[model samples]
Target: MLKFFYEEIDFKVPQSLKTSKWLKNISLSEGYKLGDLNYIFCSDDYLLEINKQYLEHDYYTDIITFDNSEEEGKLEGDIYVSIDRVKDNAINIGVSFDIELRRVLVHGLLHLIGFEDSDDDLKQQMRAKEDECLLLY
Candidate 1:
């Protein structure tokens, strides 16, 4: 199940982005199963604040994942995403909005699956895993 928690207002995500088996597939690709997954959609300003306050960085990022998996074993976390950034990225990448959105969504899920991208070397690996998971869609 995917429940959205808005950091700003009660905005609704498009019905197209609702919970799916694809998300479950992402969880399984990492040798895990999702009991519940939560996503948080916010504006660039809102997410920037979270990035600064929680991560101690002061720049805009595409997405941030909060791992809440505990003894309960649910793939719990808050996927903070900026729609404004997604729009620009879709335009720059020359992909449709839905495709770009799915990329970002999967990116955050990949992070929960032990995929790290803290440096240049690992970024490539992360991208590979992302692309690998992209095959499902």
Candidate 2:
């Protein structure tokens, strides 16, 4: 089962498998499996602190993930999503709240299963994967 915790925020959004399906599909494509995942939605301030404390990043981001799965194929992680950033990104990308939310969710899942966008090529690939995951909806 997918579970989500709210930290520094109060949102009514439920854990969605339509979202989880995208993660599970990507994991399957890469020979990974989906395990129990914990998504924590929070505010910009909270996530910014997480970024600074864990990644040395002192800026706000849409999401942060920590993979805890010991099994190679099984996916597990603590995903911290910043709803504030998601909303802002939605505006910037011209998508609805749901679309941007799914993109951010997929982005975190991709990280748990080994996906990065630190370089130009990787960024392109990540964007491609994000779009592909969106198609699963």
Candidate 3:
């Protein structure tokens, strides 16, 4: 199951049903089954607080994913997205808000799928995968 929630934000995800189906398809294509995924949309400040509390990080990030699956090859987690960051990133990168939002959304799923960006090589691989996933969206 995929669920969406908002915190300190009054925005609704556009085309939510289509987005959910696309995400499910992405998981199936990656050889995993969708378990229970929750997406929480919030302001940068809200997400920053989460980061400081949970991760002990002082910087702002677009998304923070918490993997909750006990079984291998099954996707389950909470993905927190900062709408403020997404909007700013869209403008900074010359992309539409929807496009950037989808990128962030899939980026979290990729993390749950075992993709990492802690290094340059891994970041490149993750970016390529994200681009490929965007094509499927």
Candidate 4:
């Protein structure tokens, strides 16, 4: 199941039902089943605190994903998204807010599905996957 929540913010995800089905299909396409995935939208400050406290990183990022999958072929996790960053990034990258937001949302799911962007090559691959997934949006 995919769920959406908010913290220190009041934003509603548009077309949530369609988005959930799209995400479930993406998970299945990647050879995994979608489990209890939670997307928490919050302000940059809220996310920064989470970063500093949980990740030991005192920086703001678009999204921070916590993988809680117990085994292979199952995707379960908490995806914390900074709405402030997403809006800024959307303007900086010259993309629509909706497009950028969906990209970040799926980017977190990609991480839970065993994709990483720690290196340039891996990042490129991850971006490609994100783009591919975005086509379904």
Candidate 5:
């Protein structure tokens, strides 16, 4: 089950059904099954509060993912996205808001699939994977 929620934001994911299918395909390609996935879109302030409360990080981030899968090879989690950051990133990266939003969305999913970006090499790999997945979108 893939669901989307909003917090301090009125935006809805465009072409949500298509987005859901594309995400499911990404999971399948990574040898995982889609389970319960939730996307929570919010303002920068709202996400900042969550970051401080849960992660103890005082900085702003584009997304935060919590992996909650109990079964092996199943992807389940809550992905919180900051629309404010996404919009700013889109401008800074010279990409459309839609494209950057999708990138952030899949970045969270990739984390749930065990991809990490804590190091330079891992960050490169993650970016490569993100680009490849973007092409499929």
Candidate 6:
């Protein structure tokens, strides 16, 4: 199941049903089943605190994914997204807000599906996979 929440932000995610279907498809395409996945949209400060407390990082990022998969081929986790960052990223990347937001959403799910972007090659592969998944949107 995919759930959406807002923290320290009043923004509403558009097209909830459609986005859910796309996310479920993302899981299935990767040979995994969707589990308890949560997407939390929050302000940059809120996410920064989460980063400092949970990840021990001081920088603000667009999204922070927490892996909670319990078994093989099961995708479960909490994806914390900074709305402020997303807006800035959208302008910087020359994409619309919805497009950047959806990309970040899929990016988090890809991490739960055992995809990592820790290196250049992996980042490229991850981006490619994200593009493929975004097409489903």
Alpha-carbon runs more than 4 Å astray in model 2: 14-17
Worst 10 residues of 1 by lDDT: 10-19
lDDT by residue for model 4 over 1-137, one digit each (tens)?
88999999989888889888999999998899977899999999999999999999989999999999997788999999999999999999999999999999999999998899999999999999999999977
C-alpha lDDT values of all predictions: 0.79, 0.85, 0.97, 0.94, 0.97, 0.93
Per-residue lDDT of model 6, residues 1-137, tens digit only: 89999999989899999999999987898799988999999999999999999999999999999999888888889999999999999999999999999999999998888889999999999999988888889
Report how far residue 68 has shifted in candidate 6, in Å. Answer: 1.0
For model 5, the run of ten residues with the poorest summed lDDT: 27-36
lDDT score at residue 15, model 4, on the 0-100 scale: 87
TM-score of 6: 0.97
Q: Candidate 5, residues 10-121: lDDT per residue as tens digits? A: 8999999999999999999999998999999999999999999999999999999999999999999999999999999999999999999999999999999999999999
**What TM-score, computed on C-alpha atoms, does each candidate reach?**
0.85, 0.89, 0.98, 0.97, 0.98, 0.97
Tell me which of candidates 2 and 5 scores higher on lDDT: 5
Model 1 spans with C-alpha error above 4 angstroms: 7-19, 72-74
Error of 3 at 26 (Å): 0.3
**Regions more than 4 Å wrong, model 6:** none
Candidate 1 residue-wise lDDT, 1-137, digit = tens: 66667766455655545446677876876677775678788888898999999999999887999988784445777789888888889999898877777888889888877779989989999888777777787
The predicted structure with the larger TM-score, 2 or 5, is: 5
User: Per-residue alpha-carbon lDDT of model 3 for 20-116, expressed as tens digits?
Assistant: 9999999999999999999999999999999999999999999999999999999999999999999999999999999999999999999999999
Who is ahead in TM-score, 1 or 2? 2
Can you give the lDDT of residue 9 in candidate 5? Answer: 94
